[model samples]
Target: MDHDIDVFAKNYIYQKSILLTKTAQRADWDREDVVSELTLHLLRRRDQFNPGRGSWTTFVKAVVNNRTTDLHHQLSRQRATLSLSDPRVSRVAERLEDIERLRHHGVSIDPESDQCDRTIDLNNVLSQIPQRDRRLCDQLSRFRTADAAKHLNQCRSNIYRRIVSLRKEFSSAGLTDYWK
Candidate 1:
C-alpha cells in the first residue's frame, strides 16, 4: 500500500508540473527545473499529507498550487534584480558619448543643462571603465565578493583585482567616496 501511494504521489507531482509548464509556455521557466523544485518540496513535506484530513488528490493539488506560486514569485524577483543590467543604460551612455565627442570638436555644451549634468557624475565614471569591469563593479556593490565571483564565473582573486581596478578608476574620476 505504501509503495502504491508513493508511486501515485510521484506521478501526480509530474502531472502537476506538466500542467503548470504548459500554462506558462515561456522560455524563462524550464520544465525540468520546475519539476525538480516541486519534487523536492513534496519530499520534504510528505509527512504533512494526511489522508484523514483530505483526499490524496486534494492535498497534492494544494501542494502543487503553493509550489507553482512560489516558483513564479522567485522568477519575478530574479527579473526585477536583472533589470539593472538592461541595454537602455548602454544606449543612453552611447548617446552621452556622442555629445562628449561633439564637445571635443569644440561644440560647447551647456554644463548647467539637466540632460548633460545627469551624465556628469557616476554615469560618466562608469562609462569610462570597460564593460566587463563596469558589470563587475555593479555586481560587487550588490553582492559579496565571493558571490560576485561565482556570478561572474571568476575566482575570488580576480574579483578583488577588478574591484581594485574599479576603485582606482573611480578615485581618478573623483567619485571614490560616492559609493560608500
Candidate 2:
C-alpha cells in the first residue's frame, strides 16, 4: 500500500460504493457524490494512519463512516428551508442554528429545545476543573496552544497535560460527548 495508494483507493471505492447506497437514500445525496466525498476525505486524512495501531482498511472504514455521517448533516442543513419571518419563529431558528453550531464544535447540547439545561450542565461540568485549568481552557478558546502556553507561563507540554487531565474529568463526569 506504500506506493499503491491510488490502487488501494480504487479497490476500496468499488467495494464500498454499493454499501453507501443507504447513506445516499437517508441523506438525500447522490451515490457518486458520496463516493467522491469519501475518496477526498481518505486522501486528505491518509497521513493520520498508524500502521502500528491498525490496518489501512480499518482506518479507511472509520473515516468513510464519519464522512458519510457528516455528509448527512450537510445535506440536512442544506435542505432545511424555513422561511419563517415571525418573531418567535426567527428566535427559534436562531437558537437551533446556535445549537447546531455548538454541536459542530463538539459541544453536546441536549436534543430537546430547552437550552437552559445544556447551559447548566456545561457550567456544572466545567466547575469541576481547577481554576487554573479552567483559565487554561479559556485561554485555549482564544489562542493557539503555543500562545496559550506563553500566556499561562507554562510549557506547551504542560498545557497539553492539563487539557488531557481536564478531558479525563469531563469523561468521568459523563460529559465525554462535550470533550473536544
Candidate 3:
C-alpha cells in the first residue's frame, strides 16, 4: 500500500479484469481474482513511477494493459492434462491384444537411446582428461566461472584459461555443444 489507487485506476482494473477473464474463459480465473492480481501488480510497481515523466492515470492504464495481457498470454499456454478420452487408446489396445494372442508378450519402448549414447560419450571424454584439469571441469559443472575458480583456489583469469583449454579438448572430442 504505497499509495491509494485513485478512482480512475480502480475503474481501469475492474474493466481490464473482466476482459481478461472473458478472453481466458478459464473456470479457475474469476473476475475478482484477476482484479486482485492486477491491483497487486500496480502497487508492487508503484516505486517505478516517475511523476515528472507522465500523468497518474496514464501510468495506471499502461500498467493495467500490460499486466492484463501478460496474464492472459500466460494462462493461454497452460492446459489441463488429458484426463478424458484418448484417440490412441483403442489402437494401442488392439496392437497389444494381437501381440498377446501371437506370442504372449508385452512391448517395451526405449525413447532415450540418443540421451544414453550422449551420456556415455561424455563420460568417456571426461575420463581421458587428466586429474588436475578434470577438477576444473567437475567444478565448472557445479558452479559458475567465478565460484568454480574460488572452489579450486584459482583466480578468475586462470579459470578462464582453463575453460578455454577444456573447450578446446571438448571440441576436438566432437562434443563441443556439451560445455554450453
RMSD of 2: 21.2
**CA error at residue 146 for candidate 3, angstroms:** 93
Of the candidates shown, which would achieve the greatest TM-score relative to the real structure?
3
Which of 1 and 3 is ahead in TM-score?
3
lDDT preference between candidates 1 and 3, better one: 3
lDDT of 2 at 151: 94
The best-first sequence of candidates by TM-score reads 3, 1, 2
lDDT for each residue of candidate 1 in 104-145, tens digit (9 for 90 to 100): 877666756754554465667777778998888789778988
Candidate 3 lDDT by residue in tens digits, 1-180: 255788889999999998999889677788999999999999988877878899778888888999998999999998834322554666556544544443433333232555444554565677789987888888888899899889989999988987898898888877888888
Cα-based lDDT at residue 126, candidate 1: 77
Judging by lDDT against the true structure, name the best candidate. 3
lDDT, candidate 3, equals: 0.78
Give a tens-digit lDDT track for model 2, residues 100-155: 76777887777664554455455666677678978987898799889999999999
TM-score of each: 0.39, 0.35, 0.44
- Please rank every candidate by lDDT, starting with the best: 3, 1, 2
Assess the local accuracy of residue 17 in candidate 2 as a C-alpha lDDT between 0 and 100.
62
lDDT of 3 at 115: 48
Clashing pairs in 2: none
